[model samples]
Target: MSQTLISPGISVANDDKQRLGPRTRFGLLASITVTFLAGSSVPTPLYPIYQDQWHFTAMGISFIFSIYAISVLAGLLVFGRLSDYVGRRSVLLWTTVLQLVAMYMLGVADGFTDLVLGRLIQGVSTGAAVPAVGAALIDLNHKRGAVVNALTPAIGSAVGALMGSVFAQALPYPTHTVFAALAFILVIQGVGLLLMRDIRAKIPGAARSLIPQFSIPVDVRGPMIIASSLFVAGWAVAGFFASMGPRLIEQLFALPASWAGGLVLAAFAGSGVAAIGAFVTRSMHTLAWIGALGLLIGMAMVLVSLITGSLTPFVFGVVISGAGFGAGFQGGIRLVLSKSRAEEVAGVLSVAFLCCYLGMGVPAMIAGYAVASGHGIFDTAIVFAILVMSLSFIAVYRMISGGSRV
Candidate 1:
């Protein structure tokens, strides 16, 4: 306990105002990234459960998932760089509180409206927290920052999908329990943030505009579009995994057990996480070709699985597809960051995320409608795969044609 002077003569123990060491601070920020992103997918495993109890159609499930994407896009469009204006710590703290509220809503949700509202709130919470957390992580450790940012969300979503499935299989009230558990973890983090020192200085004109801002800096536009297109293509598959992979597996393969669907998604994401590193070290053009090739082989394998009524080919397809996902997404983000002006970093990154999530959300919804309207699942997968391959090859050709260089 230490004493501090007050009014010249009075002194009291100031033990409550404790300061954390650097390692602890870094750990806290990293943990926040993991937990926030994990929360984003915790519902993936539970979607089936919701479908069963609520008696909703496939389109309903897709809409439920899509709404979260919309909420995130809206949040990023408005507040993506708010931390650059406001203090990062302050923005994180408030969003964390809202996140807690969202979790509580999920726990008690008995209706579709409640569920959608919770997801939207979650979108806002994660949306607001991600940029600040990313910015703060870089602030604390620039050397490892880029790698961490690239891998953390994929890994976190994988963990969430796996654990949510596990919890659903092992515990009661799968949806309520999973969200409640996440809420508890968030509470501890929120309280910790309240005590930790703020790191980012508040910039001027933080309150000057609430209008949505968007653009690609002119110099980086061509390369950014190519990279972002790859991200979009990869994320399209990623979104399918998160929203409909489980249901599709059940429908097509007659997979048993409620948790099996989530496991597939976890595998897909985990494989991508594993592949991100080897791909990131390559030149952007090389990454484009490799990613395109991986995606093609992966989708073809998935087609083989669908044709043969075999789970093995599908699982293998997931792995190869995941590698392409990692390669395309990470390579794009890395290239953009390498070339972005310091001031353009946050805004440009927002554009990248907007594209990535748009890919994740929009296509999944369309596929959902098609499936719901009696379109054959295998036929839809074939069409989607073809579209993704076309985008990937276009990226490769763009790279080859010198729109973007090595």
Candidate 2:
């Protein structure tokens, strides 16, 4: 809270201390973050069903989806840097509570307004949770590793989307049932938070100041800017998968609404696996290029699927794209972490995540608005595919030029 910034790097006397055993406690923390983060996207595959039940248009669906991004952006701006001052546990506990509120709202949604409001709350919860959860993973590490930390959120997103979509589509009373499952998981996470021992390196005089400040050294700013761009591109890919894929599947492939979630899950699962592998491979440079290449190939695949009108190709394209997204995200986190210190972690990472949520939320909303007025879903989907693919190719090209390695 004080005006005096703690010198960067780990904020404690022993930044390298292993407070909890690496295996059990770390896994527990990762699991907790994954469960709730995944829940945030649990509703992705079911938006069509909601539309059918509520008589909302595609534009309305986009608006509802946009709330999550807007909420996440708001959370990052307001509370993104707060965890730097407060302990991670405190922030995470509160985030869990927010998720509960969101699920409750969604479980009983009656109209378009309810859907938008509920998604907004879920967005805020996830936005707050991501930085805290991500920072906590890095903080808990005795040995340096990016894959494990990155995979926590990456894999969780995939698995959660899969579970939520499959169960919601297959089960009776999806609206209530899916959220019921999420609410139960939130309760379980709350208990886990209570049981886990608090482990954080404290900074003297850091907590007293309440104002959120974002600071990075002059030299690091260039890399940070480029990292943010990469985040934007990757997140746009993710947003499309969540918002548009289900609708596309329903309209084009004639797939049952229930199986749409599987498409989202496949992409996340591909990305999660790639992220974990990237973490352990010890050649981050290789992984970075892998991400770039994946993005190019995956985006191309998506364009092809659009042209061919094949469901199998479309789903496959999504998974390939997701693999690229995860790989790129993992690489970016590694670059940021290597360049950052503990005091600066939340502030620096917040900027990158801000770009991500912006990418995820903004365009999707615009596309949604387009869909709402009796315009064709395919027209909007085409625009989305083009925009995301363009951004991704540009980022990859810049990185290939050695402008942004991550």
Candidate 3:
């Protein structure tokens, strides 16, 4: 049971005979990361279907969506650092099992209550698994790990939204089919985990780690704040698209197809993935500025589309803002992790993602209430775009004034 210390609080169990190779482990971990996120977003396209079937209001949909975020926050607070003491593989494996249960619940869901409960379970599983898998990736390769962490959400969301849409449109049982597929994938991922190595050593304080806390190092605090702001701005837009984009598209643009919502979400997420490659060589500060400007310009276009009642501009605006979302999020993550010690990886990521989920959940929930309370989608979206634009302006100013020090 010999172990090698990789950092202050992290260690590798040297059991080459029993564990998979590092490269193999990295690939598996990355796949698992993508799978978990994909599972979370798979429900986006199905929201419209659920609404149609159950006759729920916009506020009901928002509750279902936001409840997932709330549960994720609970999971992150309680279990974010558990892997830092127990082991990454164990945490991931158990969470995968929980996700499978969630998929089952969602797959067989008959109404709103079932959907809400399923999402809550799914969110908790995703929340607990995120920090574990994120830390594991970093444990393997710091630079690549950060890139994967930054890029995977977009990639997984894009894939999930598209898949769910296609399946919902073409398949017999819309909800059942997608969740079954996700559950199958999770089963494979769990098996893969059993074959892989646990890179981190089990440490003491496993019980104390259950208490909710953030462990950000002093050096990482400044970048974390900047990153948290970017996360809040970017994910709020994503949340809106996920929860309300389909309805907005149907109402304003006259596109009633099931795939339209998924396409809009996919475009936003896909553009983000593309932004990472286009701006990979840029400095962190420059990337942040570019992202902010992109958000501002893109949101302005969205406002125009709303006013003019044109779909073309809306599509174009989504692409641009989505690019900004991707680039800005990457810059924020790179800045935060660039200064973080290895020991701070899990805690830093936990706080970062907590903010990310908060941003994603809160604004969308508010918009749902507004829409349900008499504000039209167009009006609510206009206000939402304005708020995002304001945030983007602040982000740009922060980067310019702070310079490389940020």
**CA lDDT, every prediction?**
0.77, 0.70, 0.87
Q: Give all TM-scores, in the order shown.
A: 0.90, 0.88, 0.97
Candidate 3 Cα misplacement greater than 4 A, ranges: 5-9
For every candidate, C-alpha RMSD to the true structure in Å: 6.1, 3.9, 1.4
| Model 2 stretches with alpha carbons more than 4 Å out | 1-22, 142-145, 201-215, 403-406
Write the residue-wise lDDT of candidate 3 on 1-406 in tens digits.
7877654556787656446777888888888878888887778888889999999999998899899988999999999989989889899999999999999999999999999899999999899999899989998888888888888888888899898899988899988999999899999889989988788878899999899997688888777766776888898899989988889998987886468998899999999999988998888777777788878998899999999998888989999999999999889888888887887788788898998899899999999999999999889999999998988877776766664575
Please give, for residues 41-131, the per-residue lDDT of candidate 2 as tens digits: 7777777778788887777777777878888888877778667666677788898898899889889988888877888888887777777
Using lDDT as the measure, name the better of candidate 2 and candidate 3. Answer: 3
Q: Could you tell me how far off, in angstroms, the CA of residue 403 lies in candidate 1 after the best superposition?
A: 5.9
- Clashing residue pairs in candidate 3 (N, C-alpha, C atoms within 3 angstroms): none
**Quick one: ranking by lDDT, best first?**
3, 1, 2
Candidate 2 lDDT (Cα, 0 to 1): 0.70
Runs with alpha carbons beyond 4 Å of true place in candidate 1 = 1-18, 277-289, 403-406
Candidate 3: residue 275 lDDT (0-100): 96
Best by lDDT: 3
How much lDDT does candidate 1 score?
A: 0.77
Candidate 1 lowest-lDDT run of ten? 6-15
Stretch of 10 with least lDDT, candidate 2: 1-10
